[model samples]
Target: MKSPIRIILLILGFIMLLSEGFMGLPFLGGTYILSLGWAPLGSNITMYFVMFLITILDRSNESRSSLSTIAAVDIFANMIAFIPFVGMFLHWLMFFLMLVYIGIVLNTREYRGNTTHYDRHRAGETVREYK
Candidate 1:
């Protein structure tokens, strides 16, 4: 996504988080009653939104592929959390996957090389270049 759009979404997500917290506040110590449960779901969506932003913003080949893979799996898993009787398990799985994603992001390197497919005519030259 464009920087402008990403900025807008980031701002919106922050607002959503703050408002969700405010809405979940309870009066006179009835904290348990203030559980709206929507905040978590909204935050999940916002996380995915951020993922989408990353996918478009980053130009590195390896990074883009990794982010896209994680985002696809995560968003689907989050959606699967709506399934009957398995919602909690699915959510936990998704959360675990999120940690794995973070690790990948932290360690992945930006691949910098000529990405053009090798042609028969250039095969001889390509071998000398990399070797």
Candidate 2:
């Protein structure tokens, strides 16, 4: 769970999407060899971990809107996944969203002795005026 966390989430989301297709199919006792019995739980765990990572890693420079968008995606995916046939659309949309999340994560620049957008936003306003 380091910088590679984003990659891990991407892979997990993709695998979960695929598993949702046939993992529950009735092959052996209504289950397949590649079946993931608790796939939704896995997805939830992975997504929450991602939220945790974002909360801890992001600098003030990072866009709050993007973070909120990631949370929104997680919420929407989880909610829609329980539906019947419509859930399939959510799965595909989620795969695309995973890519979007990765892009946002990759675009977020770390604060390394550099001023951030947040800093610039407050540049004109300060608690104390110059003496």
Candidate 3:
């Protein structure tokens, strides 16, 4: 991926992680705002938009699965937000899911593989020799 694209993805991921804090605040806060009925739907819509952008920026197949998982959770939470009693609970559940997704992305082996391959090449083993 291009450097600019990667930077944008990193920024967006940070924003999504930060947004989780809203879930903890008082009324007019995460859950309270969500309880306001339609407003939560709007917030969730914004989240879905951001999530979609992130998904598009992800190039690696392994990373795509985690991004899609996060998108699915966001969509599900938004849909459930239309409910009266269970919306807040679903919101919290989605928040935790996002946390897990972030952790998975950070600890993924994709970056490690690249570094390991570079090290092997640097150690003077030619591609033909490996084969």
lDDT of each: 0.53, 0.53, 0.61
Candidate 2 lDDT, 1-131, residue by residue in tens:
23454565446545544543442333431233225553663565466456646545654535546655665665666565554445556555655665666566567664456344665656787668633
Off by over 4 Å in 1: 1-34, 110-131
- Which runs in model 3 stand beyond 4 Å of their true positions? 1-7, 24-37, 109-131
TM-score of 2: 0.50
Per-residue CA lDDT of candidate 3, range 6-27, in tens?
A: 4555565666555644643434
**Candidate 2 residue pairs that clash:** none
lDDT of 1 at 125: 73
Please report the candidate that would top lDDT against the real structure: 3
Worst 10 residues of 1 by lDDT: 25-34
Which is better, 2 or 3, measured by lDDT? Answer: 3
Q: Residue 95 error for model 1, in Å?
A: 2.1
Query: Per-residue lDDT for 116 in model 3?
Result: 39
lDDT of 1 by residue, 1-131 (tens): 33444354345434533433432333411232225443455556667767666675666535567656766765666555444335445554555555655555545654545777867866667555864
Q: Name model 2 segments beyond 4 Å from true.
A: 1-42, 49-53, 114-131
Q: Candidate 3: deviation at residue 17, Å?
A: 3.6
